[model samples]
Target: MKQIFTLGTLAAACIIACAPAVADTATQPTASAGATSAASTSESRKLNKLADEYWDALARFDPVSAGESGDNRYADQIGMSIAPKNRAHQFALYRDYLKRLHTIRRDGLAQRDQTSYDILDYELTTALRFEPFPEHLLPLNQMDALPVTLANYSSGQQAQPLATVKDYRAYLNRLTQLGPWIDQAIANMREGMKTGVVQPKAVMVAALPQFKQLVAAKAEDSIYYTPVKNFPSGFSDADKKKLAAAYRSTIAGRLNPALKRLADFVEHDYLPACRTSTGWSALPHGMDWYLARVASQTTTDLQPEQIHQIGLKEVARIQGEYARIGPKMGYNGPASGLPTWVSEQAKYKPFKTEGEIIDVYRKLNAQLQTKLPALFSLRPKTPLDLRLEPELSRATASDHYTPPAADGSRPGVFWSVVNDPTEYGSTGMVTLFLHEGQPGHHFHIALMQELGLPDFRKFGGNNAFTEGWALYAETLGTEMGLYDKPEDWFGHLNDEMLRAVRLVVDTGMHAKGWTREQSIQYMRETLGYTEAAARNATERYMAWPAQALGYKIGALKIQELRARAEKELGPKFSLPKFHEIVLGEGTLPLALLEKKVDRWIAESK
Candidate 1:
């Protein structure tokens, strides 16, 4: 199923549920407290059973998640997460679950069972901590607005199924269901305005066209019109005609008006009232919210200032590396000028067609496949595909990977943002593939799903491990022979530099009260981001605090672990074995990961 909490879900992402739900295992009671007692073992099993039931209930309540999980039982249900009543009920469920979990004796469980208990407890508590905040009021970001994701779903081109008559009807149900939710979304934003918890005007402005596109003047113009035009082959003409008529009526009558209402609300009301300040600290309890986000995203208690210092050190190191390679690229300047020179260099962007861009990705895949055996013994059996982002969503879409369907119907897909060919630089393509495709998300996410682990462990992830492993994967370019040339190496380092800059800038904006302009200027000066790119990147961090920090922080930790394993194991160190241990258990918090690596080291020795 899609992530029970998607990285794109505005409410979840805003509340930090998208991050790894890790808690203080020491303070919380675990079955290990029972010291191998039979009662403890029984309690652990009971808790496991309860955890499964909890997930099953959660999956049922979240329709998009249900469909993504490869379960179609709740395909017809569309949840109104932004509604006040819905939030209240969800919070109630979380409390009830936590209460039930606490009743279970954690003192007698085994190590594995204890870990599961801690994870579940953490997930529930992390979820509960946000209940006091009015995050639902600011549910739409430029990047992950509910309307945009719904449009993709209703279009029958995404995770939503459209194989049969029932599937078509299911989507129709979903569209009808979304109308009230969209209405509630507007109402929530209205509440946000009153409480000063609304999204920034810049973010709201970015979201304007997305809502406008959904509110088509003609039924045929609507994204929802896609299903009617492409009926299933097995559908009889009578059935197709009836469904088409129903869809057109639904689009024109219910959906179009609902979307128009939302579009008007956003443009006329929300936009003007949206906050001008970019930082979260500008809002009520904004600093605390940002702090919570930092802790959740990094899975650490490191303060923003500490992370900022770390970022500065990392930026300095990466700049030194970038400077060393400057003369090779025909530039002889100080490290500080490298970003500007890279921005000015036109030779880096070579692809003239969408085909040319995709060709490079496919070639990169082929190259990585051949070199896989040297570093990774456990490669994903699930196939990976490279495809362009749909033209409609290309405006906001960035290069990303979609994990394979849990049931294996869909292969892992690497979606390239090929909107404008000239804008697409060839220099970063190798590093991009390394991070998003093979041995990156495609490898890490698929392996978790492939293993018959607990539902939470399989699909649930912390941003740090998920993004960290991918960034760390970029560093693997050297070992895999992908970054052989200076340009390719430059691409890798340039991307690394951006992640480091994220540390400085994300904290600078939220904690230090840096203006949006200041953050954008820093990105352009330090990381070679273009003006447009800098604004977009800065806005993303503004929309979601501490999330950008995950890439560099995660990558550094993984690299550190690898170095420790290598140094301690000496000749006994096995690259493939080390990889197996790191990735075998799917995503973990950095602390747990370090412990796992330490254990592997001791065992190897």
Candidate 2:
């Protein structure tokens, strides 16, 4: 699943954190002896204001990000997220902020204020490192393409508002901006081809169907036409007629043509020239580029070889766990063979309808609610909605969580793809819900929004922390009394195995020069992934480097911290309070998180 930005394209990818427009209900922490003076208080306020200004400028520059942030001020605006000019502008913005941030003396700031400084500093520098790579050229993919994002937002199910005539007009404005953006994207890809920076042929091939699906012969059949069809209650008949006609004109005359052109270019022009090689190291300055991505995603100085070795160890451990569980589940198959056996079991694939699949998840959610308070002292106030992945996005989508609207207009949603009901298994339901719903992303993200943290703290996030926290949350499924059955417990290991396998295959393909076929084979043999599943996973790592590394790296760090906390605090250790501390300040880099928890440990002692 794609992280934070709903518009999962290149332009929106670099935005690691942003704040939702939530009321400031969270009180500031008390100042320590080092930070209690009036001067320190004034300095903290100055930093807060500076951070606000910084994020406000950022939200205005990228309308897609603003839309994701629940800031409707730029709702009518849509710009090319990865256009060269825009990239240059964003780079300059980061540089300017970094220079200004340097001018603010960091000494004697409150603990939380210091955290904001460090996170902002790290994010700014990390963003700058991305400037050297040709990310704009490889803008769209099957998992995070513009077509899927547009279809999702326009379906009246995402962050874009469609509640009033003004909201409808704003959406129309965004549609108008698509033609130029699409042209720019095509141009960037063409330039990339000349520079040996083209996307993998498989990715481009997979994206063709999505583009075709997005365009329709009739404007009324387009996903963009949905808002017009389902107009709000207050519009007068005249206004409805006028807006409906305008939407039809925009979708047919402007939007559909753009989609068709892009699809034709990808199928006829781009695909023929697309690179057959899967590794980023195949491109010019590819090794450096891959390393940059590794550092950015993991937010660490880890080498690929190091990460690969870690993955190897993790894979072996999870395999041992899987082996033990297989026999307990009445399967005599080897541990390496358990996933295939369970995937094919009739008892696991019991659902007959899509509604049944969704209902089963809802029941899982209900069961977890009664158990959440025991593990979490603080929970997100935002309501959680369980949904089926939208029809247009399901083919490319996985079961994932989408954050609540910053304005709380819509609740956070955990969507599972139900492409074929009978084939959808229930073995992973509890852990999936735990990871995507409460005590996972929903808890970490929504609580940040609800707490009224700075916009950067509220919206800005690193993958290691965000995804790691979710992976760690999956381990708590048993604590919640959800994974009692051996098959159910095995599903948790299967998922963990997937993350560990990612470490190996992602590093193998990118740094070790392993071919796509080799990576796929490794995944199937070691993780029990079917050939099709293995190929998809391999392609995903190929598309986004080092991203898969974050789950294991982050989860390991969190688990390590929790273990340390439990050991040091001894009888004083409180699971709920430790959870509160971990999530209390929102998403942080692994190092910052360690420091925060260490301070808490010291204070507890």
Question: What is every candidate's alpha-carbon RMSD to the true fold?
Answer: 3.1, 4.0
TM-score for predicted model 2 compared with the true structure: 0.93
Best by lDDT: 2
Instruction: Report the C-alpha lDDT of model 1 over 438-485, residue by residue, as the tens digit.
Output: 889888988888777687667566778888899999888898777878
Each prediction's TM-score against the native?
0.93, 0.93
User: Which regions of candidate 2 are displaced past 4 Å?
Assistant: 5-36
Q: Can you write out model 2's per-residue Cα lDDT over 387-414, one digit (the tens) per residue? A: 8887856766788887887877888888
Residue 260 lDDT in model 1? 88
**Candidate 2 worst ten-residue window by lDDT:** 17-26
Return model 1's CA RMSD, one decimal: 3.1
The segments of candidate 1 whose C-alpha lies over 4 angstroms from its true place after superposition are 1-41, 65-73, 105-107
Report the Cα lDDT for residue 423, model 2.
89
